[model samples]
Target: MGLTQRALPDTPVGPDAFVLGRRRLRSGFRRSDTSRFCDDVWRLAPVLHQRQQASLILNFPAIPARFRPAVKVLFYALLNNKPPAGERQLGVVTIHGYFQAFKEFLDWLDPQHHDRFSSLTPVDLCQFQKHLLATVSSAKQRANHRRSVRLLWTWREHLADDHIPVDPDRLEDDWNEDNSRARRRENANPRIPEQVISPLVVWSLRFVDDFADDILAAQDEWLALQKKTRRDSHSGHGARRRLAALMRRYQADRRPLPGGTEGQHGINIRHLAREVDCDRQSLMAPASWGLIEQAREDVGVDDSTYLRTEIRGLLDGEPWLKRISYDEDLVVLVRILTAAAYTLIAYLSGMRDSEVKHIRRGCLTTDADRTGKITRRKIISMAFKGEGTPLGVEATWVVGRPVARAVEVLDRLQPKRQRWLFAVPPSSHSHKAPRTTEAKTTKATNNDLNLMVTWINDYCRQHGRTDHIPDVSRRPWRLSTAQFRRTLAWFIGRRPGGSIAGAIQYRHLSIQMFEGYAGTSKSGFRAEAQQEALLARGEGLSLMVDRHEHERLRGPSADEARVRLDKFGDRVRFLGKTPDDNQMKKLMERNDPRIYPGRFVTCTDNPNRRLCRLPGEKDMNPDPGQCKPLTCRNVALTDSNAQAWLQRLAELDARLQASDALAPRVRVRLEEDRAEIQAFLTRAGVLEPADAST
Candidate 1:
C-alpha cells in the first residue's frame, strides 16, 4: 500500500510520467492524482458519473500474485498506447472490461509452471478456449474473453517478457466461432416505437410551443423577487418603516394580503418581505407579527397565491395553464419546460444525449437575410462520438426555428452564471440552483423525460382532454435520450414529405441531416439516415409480401416483383431468431434494385425496359419524380394504385363537367385523355370492358 516512487516502474509508457486518467474528464482534474501508475490499486474513473460503474478500479491484488506484476505492466502499456486502428485510446470502460476478461483466461490457465505470459503456447491458448466453451454459454461474453487475450498478443512488443509466443486467436481454426455470430453496425439501444414517439413529441411541443410563455413568465417573476430580496438583506428600523408603508398601501387599496399556493393556505411572508424591501426575518420577527395580523384582519388575504403572473400560453384557443400563481407551481412548471426544451432539441436536431446536455449557454446562432429576416439557424456544441478525443470536438447542427427557440428558452431557464444550458432546474431548495455545468446525469435525464410525460398526462386528464400520450400495453413507453436521434432518422427515412402541424417539415429536416444542409458533411448523421432508409425500404417490401398485397399487381415485371418480394419476405422471416438491423442490412444489400413503392405507381425496376433513367445517370434506383407511370415498362399497380387512379378519374370527370371553364377543343382533348386512362386501366385488368368503352 505504501509503495514509494522508486519502487514503481521507472520508465513511463507515453509521457515522461504515466497518464492513467480518462479522456473525457471534467475540469479541475489533475493527472498527478495518481503519481505511481504501477500502484496495485489504480483509479479507473474517467468522467465523474453518478453511477457506480464510473467508480471502477483495477484490482491487481485479485489476480494470482505471480501474475499481478505482469498484468499491471501490461495494463500501463495498454493505457498509454494509442490504438492501432486510428481510434482514440481505448475507452476507460472498455479497458476495465478487458481487465475482467483477461483475468478469466489467467484464472483458467493457472499457469504456475511458467512465470511469464510469453511462456504460454498456441496449444495453451487452444486449451483456454476449450475452457471458455465449457464454462461460458453466452457467445458474446466468451468472444469478449478471447478478444482480451488477442489484445495481449497484439501488444507483444510492449509486453516484452510478458507477451505470448503465438497468436492466441488462431484464425485458421474455428476458435472465433463465438465472435463470428456477432453482427456489425447494430445499435444496442432500440429506437422508440412510432406510436409512443408521435404523441410524446406532440405533448413535448405542446409544453414548449403552447405552454412555455406562462412558465417563463412565472420564472421572470421569481427572478425579480429574488433580485429584490438580494438587494435589501438587512432588517433594521429603516426596513421596518418600509414594511409598514407597504402594509399601508395594501390597506389603502382595500385588497387582501397575498396568500401562499402549493397546498398552503396562509399569507405569504416571503411575498411581504419581497414587496417591503426587507429581509424575510424582518417580516417573520415576533414583534412585527401583531402588526401583520392586524393588517391581515383589516385588509383580508387572498388564499390562493401571491404571484399574479398572467398565463399567456393558449391551448386550443384557451389558456393552457389555469394560473402560474404558487411558488411550487412555478418551480414545477420550469422543470417541465426544461424537459420540453430537451425533447425538442434532442428529437428535431438529431443530436446525441451528451452533445445536447453539453450545449453551452450561448450555443445558438442565426443567419439573417439582407432584409433582416432569419434564414438559417445552427447550434454549436461538443461531439464526443468519433472525435477521437476524451473531450469532444466542437460540432455544429444546422437546425430549424423550433430548435432555436428551445435553446433560447434553455438559456433563460437556468441561472445566468450557469455555464451549461442543462443545469439543475431552479427550485426553492437550491436558491436559483447551482451554477455548475453538470446537472442531470443520464439516469436523471431519463427520469426527467418520463416524468414530463406523466405530468403531461395528468394535466390532460384534469383538462378533460383525450389526446394524452397513450401508453403501450397499459404502460408508458420507457424513454431514454438514446431514442431520439435514431427515431428522427427512422422518420426521415420513411416520411420525408410528412408534416407535423404544418410546423415540423420532415423533408427539410431530412435534408438538414445530410451533407448538403451544412458544410459539416463529414458528420455521422448521413450514414445513420441512409442505414434507416435501407431498413425502411426492406421493411416495406417485407410487409407488403406478408399481406400478399403484391398478388394484385399488374405490370410487365409482375412475376419478377413476386420472386424478389418472396425472397425478401423469406430473408426477413423469423424462423427461430429474429434478425437484427445489421443482418437485415446485409440481406437488403444483396437484394438491391428491388421493388420501390410509390403513391402513383409501384416501380418493379427493370434496367433494359426502364424509361425514367437519365441518359448519363447510372444510378440503379429509379428517380420517382421522373417516373413515366402510364407507359413505363417498370410500372406496377396494386389495389391501392387502382383506387388512386379511380380517384384521379373522378376528379378529371368533375373538371370536365365545368363546361363554362373549357373551350370545345380543350373539352375534346380532356375527353380523349380520360378515354386513354380508362382504356389503360381496362387493359391493365383494373376495370371491365364496358367502362373502358364509356
Candidate 2:
C-alpha cells in the first residue's frame, strides 16, 4: 500500500503522528509546475526556504508570464551555483531583497514593455537608476536596488540573446558627476569596550566553574520528568486527576488555561502534557475521569510563587526542594544554564556565530604529555568560513580551561543521542517529538543570546544584584556575535596595562598569539584592531602635542621635540578632529611622521634619519622596545613620563630612609638607581636646581 493511501489511525497517538499524517496528505496532492519550482528552490536551500516561498508567492505572479520562466531560471542559477572566492551564497534575505527590487522595476515599466523581451533599453535602465536614487532614502539601499536591477538585466540578456544591450555600470557615470553621495558607507562593527567586557568575562568564568553542577542537575531532572510524563500519560490511572489539578491551579493564578483557539484563551493541553511529561490524550479525558476538584482543593498554594521560592532556594545552595515538582522548575533552570554556557563559550573562544553553532558533542578533547600532564585543550568543529575547498571541512580552536568546562556542561545537559552541542530539543507539545534535535542556526543563536542577556539582567534584579551588564551608549548593548572576536583582538593587540589574569600582565603577550582570532577578512577583527591601534597612536600623539603647546615638556631632545610637535599640530589642524578612524589610518599609512610609545621616550623614528639603528643596515622600521633614549635623537620624553621617573626616585629614596636593616650592597644599588633617574631628569631640564637641592 502507498504511504499516503494507508489509513491514519482513528485517534492519532500523539502530536508527531498527526503532523506526519497531515504532511503525507499534503504531499499526495498534485502541485502546479510553478509550485514545484518554488518547492525545489526551498528544498535546495533550506536556510532561506520560508523567505523564498514568500517572495515567490508575492512577486512571481505579478511578473509577466513570458518573464516568469526567466526569473525561475535566475533563482535556480543563484541557488545551485558556487559563489566567487571569499563570497558566500546569496542568503534568503538577499534573494527576497532582489525580488522586491525586480517587482518595483516591473511595476514602473509600461504594460507593453512587460512581455516585450527586447524592448528594454539603456535609457530605461538609466531612468530606473535615477528613480531609485531619488526615491530611496538610504544610499546603501539605493546601491542594492541598482545592483539588483543590473543583475536582472544580465540574466534577462542571457535568457534572450536579442535583448537590448544595456551597460548597467555606465548608468551611474552619466547620472551624476558627484559620486560621493552614492558611495558605499562605512559600516564597521564596533568592539565591546573594555569596561563592559571585563566584568562579563569574570562573571562568565565564575558561572561555568562554580554553578555548573547545579545547572547540570536541573537539566537532568527536567529530562527525567519529560520521560516520566510521557510514560504516565499512556497508562497511569491517576494521570487525568493530576493534569486537572495543574489546569485549575493555572487558571486560578490568572494564567491562561491551555489548549484553546488562538492558544491565548487558555493553556494548551499538549503544552501542559509536555510541561508535566504526560501525553495529550491523558489531559483530554473528561473531568469525570477522576477526582479533579478534590485534587485542585488539595493543592492550594499559588504555583508561580511556590516555583520561584523553590528555585531561589536551590540557587542559594539549599538542597533541591524535594516537595516542589521538577516539572515546575524546568523552564527557568534550562534558560539560565543555556545562557551561562553560551556566554562563556562565545566570549572566551572568540569563535564566529557560524563556527560556534557548529560545535558538536565530543568536540572538546584533551592532549597530555608523556607524564600525563595535560598540555593543550582544543575544540574540534567544522570551519564555516573559507570552506570553498569542500563543504564540512574540519577546524580546531585551542580553548582555555573555562571554555572546556562550559562545553562539558553543555554536553552533559544535552541528550546522549544528540550530536550537536547547542541543539535545542523540541518541546513535547511541539509537532515534533522530544529529543528530535536540530543544530542552532546563526540567526536563532544570536536571538537566543540577546534574550539570554535580558533574562540574566532580570534574574539579577530579582536576586538583589547591582552588577548589571551595561549599554555601550544610550542603547542597550545589542550583543552581536562579531563583537566578541573584535573586542578580544583589541585587548590583545593594544595591551593596556593591568593584570589580565592574576599576576600575568597583558603587555607580556605577543601579537602573534592572537592573530588566529583576529582573522584577515576586510570586516573582521584584524582590520578593526589595526584601526584601533591607529586611533591609540593618534590619541597618544595628541596628548604629547597638547603638552608641548603648554610648554610642559623639557629635555635634551626638546629642540627636536618642538620641531616634531609643531609638525604634528599642523597635521592635526589639517585633519580637523580626525573624525573617523580611517582618516587617522590614512595619516599612519604615510609612515614618515609616525610616533610609537617606548619605556622612557616616544620614538618619532624615520628610518632614513634614525639615530637608534644598530650595525646592520636594512629595513627602516623602528624597534621602540630596543630604543636607547640617552643616545637616540629620535626620542622625546614628555613631562608626564618624566614625572613618573621622578615619582619612582622619590619612592626609592623613602625606602632607603625607612629601612635601617637593608644590606650594604642593596643600599648601594638603590642609591645608584635613584641617582641615574635624577641625572636623566636634570639632563631633560625638568628637575629645577632648587628642588634638586632638597
Candidate 3:
C-alpha cells in the first residue's frame, strides 16, 4: 500500500514557532496491512516520497522533543526510492499522537534499530521490552507499549506470510504473554479481589428505576433479535398501542431521540470541557455530565444555579448541601433544633428518652423559686455537654423564665420517679416490647421512617415546593438519619460567631450552606476548658514553667492518676491494653478521641469518663456480659447515687411507655428502648437476674 501524503505548506499557519518534522501520512497503512497484505503497497510509495521532502524542511524544535528522531526516520522511509521488498516502508506515524510517542519509545529502546521490517531478533526484542517496562512508570503506558509491540509483531507475521523473508523474531512476540502474566499477578497473590463499581453504572441502575419499563422493553427487543424469524401470529395493535403511550411520555419529557433529536441542545463535548474545566471525551461518555444533568432536571431540581452548585459539590465529593428557605419551610426549621437535640445530645449524654427527653420540666430549673412562673428558671439538662474525662461536662445553658414555666408544667405532669417531660402514656401505641431479631434493636424501622419521608414528600408536593430535595435538578427528597450528623458537622464547622459573646450576631444567616445543624461542639467545649486552665497558670510563667506546670498538672497526684487511670483501664479493659498507654495510643492512632493535647487526661482509662466504652471489648467477648450501672468518680456510686440512678431509669422507662410518646405509630419504640436499657445495664457492670428473659 502506498503511504498517503500531502505536500507540506510552504508556510506554517501557526505561530513562527510551528514547524513540521519529518513524518509520514499513508493510506491503507493500517498496522495490520503488512507485506502479506500487498497489492496496495504501491499506492503508499508517493505519499512516503512527499513525507521525506517535508521532513527535510521541518524544524527540529517544532517537533516534540521525544518524537524528533522517529519523525526523521518516518520521513526517510517515505523518501525511499526502491520499493521495499520484505515489508512495505509506508510512513503513517502521524495518524495518532500516541503513535508518535510509541515510535519514540521504540527508538529509545534501541537507537540502531530503524524498523521491525528490516531485521530483528527475539533477544533484541526482549531487551527492548525489558527497557520499556523498566523505564515506564505508569502501568497503563507500559500496557499500551506492549499492545503496540504486539501489533508490530502481527504486522511482521503478515509480511513473512507474504513470502517477504521477514525475521520471525523481529518485533517483540511475547509482549502479550508478559502483560497477561503481570495482570494475573496483579489480580492474585496477597491482595484480595476488590470490587470497584463505576459511579456511572450505579447511576444507570438508579435511572433504571425512573425508566424501567422502557429499559425492559428495549432489552426484550434486543433479546428477540437472536431468535429465528417467524411469521407474525398476533396483531400489532397491542405493541403499537404500548409504543404509542411510550412515545407520548417520551415526547412530553423531551427525551433524546434516536440518532439525537432535531432540537437537541448543541453542547459540544469539547465546549462542555472548556466550560466545566474537565476532559471533553469524558463529558461525551455515556451517563456523563450532560446525561446526569438531564436526569437531575427530570427529578425537578431545575434551577441552573442549584445545578451548578450540585455539580461542584459532586465533583468535590462532599456531601450535598441542603437548601433552606425560611419563607417556604419555616415549620421544618422549627423542628430542626429539637430533632437534632435527640440525635446528638442523646448519644453524647447517654440519657434515655425517659429521662433527659423532657427539656420542659421543673427539675431542670435554675432558680430556687419552684413557682410555675417563667422567671429566672433554666433548663439544666439542656445545658449539659459530655467529656472523655472523669470531670464530666458542666451545664452551659442557664434557665430563663420561659424555660422554667415549661419545666414546671412538665414536673407537674411527670411521674414521681420519671423526670422526662415528653414521656408517653402507658397506653401509647409504641409501648410493646420488641422481639430480638438481628443485632439491630428495633425502636424504629425503615417502614416508620419511610412513612415520615412519604409525609414530607407529599407535603412538599401539595405545597408546589418540589425543590425540597437539595439537588439542583431533582425533587423526591430521600432524607436519612446519616444526613443529620453530616448536616450538623457542616453547620458547626462553618458557622461563625456561634460560641462566644461579642461576636457577629447571626453571621451564618446569609450563608446557604451554613444553615444546617446548629449544635455546639462537645470537643470544642472541652478544649476551651483546657485553654482556660492553661491560661489560669498565668502568662508570667516561662515556657519551662508552662511545660513543667502542664506535666505537674497531668500527673494526677500519684494515687488519683493511678486510680483514674485504672478506672479508665477497666472500662476499656476490652481494649486489651492499659488505658493510659494503649487507649491513648488507639485514640491517637484512629484519631477518634476528640480531646486536645493540653486537655485534662480525658481519654483517661476510666470507663466512667465518657458515655461509651472503649472498643475491642466486643471482639474479646461476643456474648453479652453481666449488667452494671456505669460508675464515675465525679458522681459517687454510693447507695444514694445507685438508688437515684435506678429510680431515674425506672422513671424513664415509665415515660417511654406513655401513650403520647414520640413516634407513637410504631409499636417497637418502647421495646427498642428496653433493649437499649439492657445494653446499658451490661455496660454499667450490672447483672440482671438469671431468670429474666429480657
Worst 10 residues of 1 by lDDT: 1-10
Q: Cα lDDT of model 2 overall?
A: 0.56
- Residue-level lDDT for 576 in candidate 3: 60
Each prediction's total of clashing residue pairs, residues at least 3 apart in sequence or on different chains, is 1, 9, 42
Estimate, for each residue in 1-694, the C-alpha lDDT of model 3 and write its tens digit. 1121221223112121111122233443453332211121222221332111121122333444333333333333333322345544333322233354446555565456344333545655566667767787766566656544443443432232221133323343544333443453221111100111111112222222222232223323322332322222331433233334533453576542222111124322232232333443444444454453453355422221111111112212432224322122222322321232333232222232322342433445343446754433333443222333222333333322222333343343334554444443121233244422111111332232233344434545665644222221254333333332233332232332223211212223212112111132243322322232233222212222224322232221223433433343344445564333223333333432122121112222234343233444532211112222233221212223334545655766676667465566453666665565445443433426551234
Q: Of the candidates numbered 1 and 3, which has the greater lDDT value?
A: 1
The best-first sequence of candidates by TM-score reads: 1, 2, 3
Candidate lDDT scores, in order, read 0.72, 0.56, 0.33
For candidate 3, give the lDDT.
0.33
Give the per-residue lDDT digits (tens) of candidate 2, residues 215-323. 5655555555446645563445566556666656665665433333222224334445665556666555565224333433444223321221223224347543333
Candidate 2, residue 333: lDDT? 48
| Model 3 spans with C-alpha error above 4 angstroms | 1-98, 113-118, 155-694
Compare the candidates by lDDT and give the number of the best one: 1
